[model samples]
Target: MAITKDTFKHVDYLWDDEKAKALGDDQVALLLYRSNILGADLRITNYGGGNTSCKTIEKDPLTKEDTEIMWIKGSGGDIGTLKRSGLAGLYMDKLLALKNVYRGLEFEDEMVALFNHCIYDLDSKAPSIDTPLHAVLPFKHIDHLHPDAAIAIAAAKDGEKITNELFEGQIAWVPWQRPGFDLALQLDKALKANPGIRGIMLGGHGLFTWGDTAYECYINSLEVIDKASQYLEDNYGKDRPVFGGQKVASLPEDERREQASIIAPHLRGLASSYNRMVGHFSDDERVLEFINSNDLEKLAPLGTSCPDHFLRTKIRPLVLEIAPDTDLSDMTEVKAYLEKEFEDYRQYYTKYYEDHKRDNSPGIRDSNPVVILWPGVGMFSYAKNKQTARVASEFYTNAINVMKGAEAVSSYVSLPLQEAFDIEYWLLEEAKLQRMPKEQPLSRKVAFVTGGAGGIGKAIADKLAQEGACVFITDINKDNLDTALATYGKDTGSGALMDVTKMEDIEKALKAACLKFGGVDIIVNCAGLAISKPIAQTTEKDWDILQSVLVKGQFAVSKVAVAILRAQDKGGDIVNIASKNALVSGPNNVGYGTAKAAQVHMSRLLAAELGPDKIRVNVVNPDAVIEGSKIWEGEWAKGRAKAYGITVEELPAFYAKRTIMNEIISVDDIANGVFAFVGGHLSKSTGNILNVDGGVAAAFVR
Candidate 1:
């Protein structure tokens, strides 16, 4: 079921004959297109280190006529896991047109020309290096691979002989050839020699097979690999491979832990000093075992699974084999080891350059090992990207497996030191370092808060402004504008008297803020009014005013904020204050509840629509806080007591006792919640409603 080498070969051989039988035909073409060759190839090879293609007739979107095209894997993608953009389409006629103009041009340029044809003719998709091979293939489906078995046998000293023994009369074999036109040409010659061969194996490289259908091609590739893997497994799997020359005893956990704790501080210091925050490590048994082993020196080098990955994880890991009590935290110990490793690398580079000519511009890297496998400690994977982090892990994992096995046969030998250096410092590799992302608490920031005059909105404004943000505050009362300016503005904060009801006023204020602050990064609409008239006595006018401010105001502010935030090209955050009444309707507060409910729903809708621009919108529903507002003192507090048939003095205690914690929600607590929504830590959350209410709302108030 799961694809492997055995299944690949079976499919490859069957599809080869099947394709030969079908030949060039319209009906067979449909069958070839139906199989999941891409999925099969990924399973059989090192994570899409293969390529699969079909010569198909695709109708032009505008012209509506069939045009012959060769669909090949795009550059920078593994065929083992093909994504939508992984495959690029090239006009067959244009690619074939280049075959005549070939007069030994630069391989990269020739590739560019072919790729350019795809870009110019079709939206400029970067064609794979194997595009020429696919273009030349006469079959409907062609697959290319670097099966582990084939490559292991090929990279061995006597690859040619071993390959002959493995295939016998069934497959064609080619000598070691570089992967571009040269390999394609060599493959052409070998295919011609066998004529009736089922598949072709490129020595020291990989395997390639083709068939009429995608399934046949995938199966053939699988079967061939299956046979090779069985042969290797039989020969090698009898016992675990051992390292030769020296064997050291592993350290126990007590010693490793002591060393780890001592070493952890230094590592933490190194990361912190370098401004890299090292995440906490959760120890696992296997990780502990690997760290305390003695074969660490043999583990670093056997790492390059593919060519490009070599740059991400280098050719080896750093081996630290020492006694359990070794004090790694001591600067003398760390520095001496670091220097010795550096010196060894320098010597290796000198030797490597003697054999291969390489330029100095991208010269030698500082050559700091990204992964270090401590003999008594587990390995560490380091990289700027999470993808590279996994790449480092995989590289080290495979290297350890191969070297551990090789130790039995002989000491593990990695790629020559200079060879690894040359690749690491190569121009292509150096290019990856350009244009690194910036480090900022809030990069290209902006914020918008309604009811900016008081309470949670002001706290949010202060928090955001502290972390390098420009804030825009709006309130219906013009009198509060000057005070907010004095408080939040403090030279950076700007206030406006824009009622959230009037879209025009909201737009005018937001436009001015964008012009003044450059753009908006976050929006916290904390402005809301609470009137506690019983439902039977609540008037439509009162309901309308509350809804206009709570519901329509949120919609208006967010709609305009979204436009400014999107144009700013920096992501935005919108936080709205809905009362806990929105969730649990209270008696005599029908108007307030309905308006707040609308505010909550609109926040969710805006969050979804604005997600494309990376704008986040969330609602915070807080319980009654009697610190600052007249609403808290005059109506809300008194009304709740009347409803409960208690004195106003007893209302706070009544609500506090209703919660499991018997704790009351404070204005400061609500302010802190709003502050978090507007700042650095809660950046990823959107459409999340947080309840800052005590037990009366069961912690579901927000």
Candidate 2:
């Protein structure tokens, strides 16, 4: 990849022209300050990874006098090469009003008011989403970036030591924070906490510093990143690891359009929901090679460049390991892969936020990574425009390299899941959310559940039915379906009897469900049999029955169900009931556990295969669910009781006490886990294992 001259030369122009541009006069100096600071801001980090702004008094045509407004960059303009037209004006008074007043305002509302009140013209590009930070900063010029070198050192084990030695006491350190409003608020609090600070090192992020002049701000970024880069060159790996591989070309135009068509719907949903345009493309060869890599596990670390970048990049990019023997031109397969990938991203966000936030305000800025990597194709970054995409690419490239270096020294530790969530969804983070618009991608959705008689299946069925969805509750046992109808039947809800393992039965049942509800929005495969026995003692008959119940049952139902869901045009959601044993091997009960494990993989494969149709598949791994079901009282449960050397009555207690917190795992808890996934709240989630196990058998108790 060739580095363009515009990338470096344009930024350095300020060094020569600064003195010529402004000799004095405060307003002219401020403009010069902004121009110089912004030039360095762009080069300090990657393209769109940094921002610079100047707050000054300008005459308001409507007010007919001098009024304060913030001249911030638009969403996609690169800070380093930012032109005069790139700046979006924001009302300084409106921002000042929101500075200390924190309640009764939503994320999008604040953003809208800030943008609308301050912008010079409505036709111009909206103010940068980082407007809040500028609003809060007291400096005449502000510069911030995810500097590659600085973060590399700051993320290390000896980061504090190195950071202390590098700048002495000039820099104040901020722990990693999800960007947006919460980050702005945190910086505000930090300033209050420490009276005088010229620079801030955001752990795991990059660097933030401001000065009275643009030159100072620009110098600060270069000096800091250069210092850290030199330190890394000296202390890190002396021998550079070779990235030997074939350089792949960009996707052809037709292929690009095909890719766009497949992902456009979901992209639109994301854009509408977040109120941020989601312009994206997969053009990079390295990203494509990475996505198309043979190893799935290795792809986990290729997330966003920084925590805040997740808003654009998502948690991780999709891996496109297209098999040689497979149909390469199948756009359906491509679509399936993308949808499935998005679903899991949503699940991760939900689980991350669940146990972390103690307060229930808009807690982390929801940052989902937007990059996609195709095995044979190149990697792609998503942004509102070309500039933002370039920024994402640059930051991600540097971050990935640093991560490689860190891995060589010692493993890079991720923030605790809950703590990560706290930053991602904090009240202060809600500012970004407010800027978004309302979206209903799965609107007019209707769903049906098989084996909606008891336990996990019934819980999922009931929740969807309550969420304005027309639901069909089915069971092989007529009595159970009858009972379900009696309990839940309402305007659009109904019930029926069908054996999901039987194809004819599933076909007939789905026909009835569609006829009654007009179409299906989702499918929940909740039907399966449980018979636990050791592999050594297991008979061929037992294995057959178990596989028949778990795998065949799901296959039979989904085959016809997918057709109906596709016709509806609205995307569908699928939830499968899996056990904790599926994740960790089950003890002794090889027959049941093995079959269940296969069921999990089956869901995953289905997710990968069915995603293009906008149908998502996910598995719910519940541990020790013992409510509203005969499984708890069946002979199988009694046998397990004997194996554990406890009576059937004491078994629940045994499982409950096994967790670190000694919290009992209930049916409702499992239900809630399923509910979060099935709800539009997790629209981008699928092909994931959600453990609703209440801290089950953790190696260490916190």
Highest TM-score model number: 1
TM-score of 1: 0.53
Question: How many clashing residue pairs, candidate 1?
Answer: 49
**lDDT to native, each model:** 0.60, 0.62
- Tens digits of per-residue lDDT for model 1, 385-500: 22444455554453443343333322334455555555556453354455334534643355677887776666666666666566678877777667778765333567688878
What is the Å distance of residue 33 in model 2 from its true position? 8.3
Instruction: Give the Cα RMSD of candidate 2.
Output: 22.3
Q: What TM-score, over all chains together, does every model reach? A: 0.53, 0.44
Worst 10 residues of 1 by lDDT: 273-282
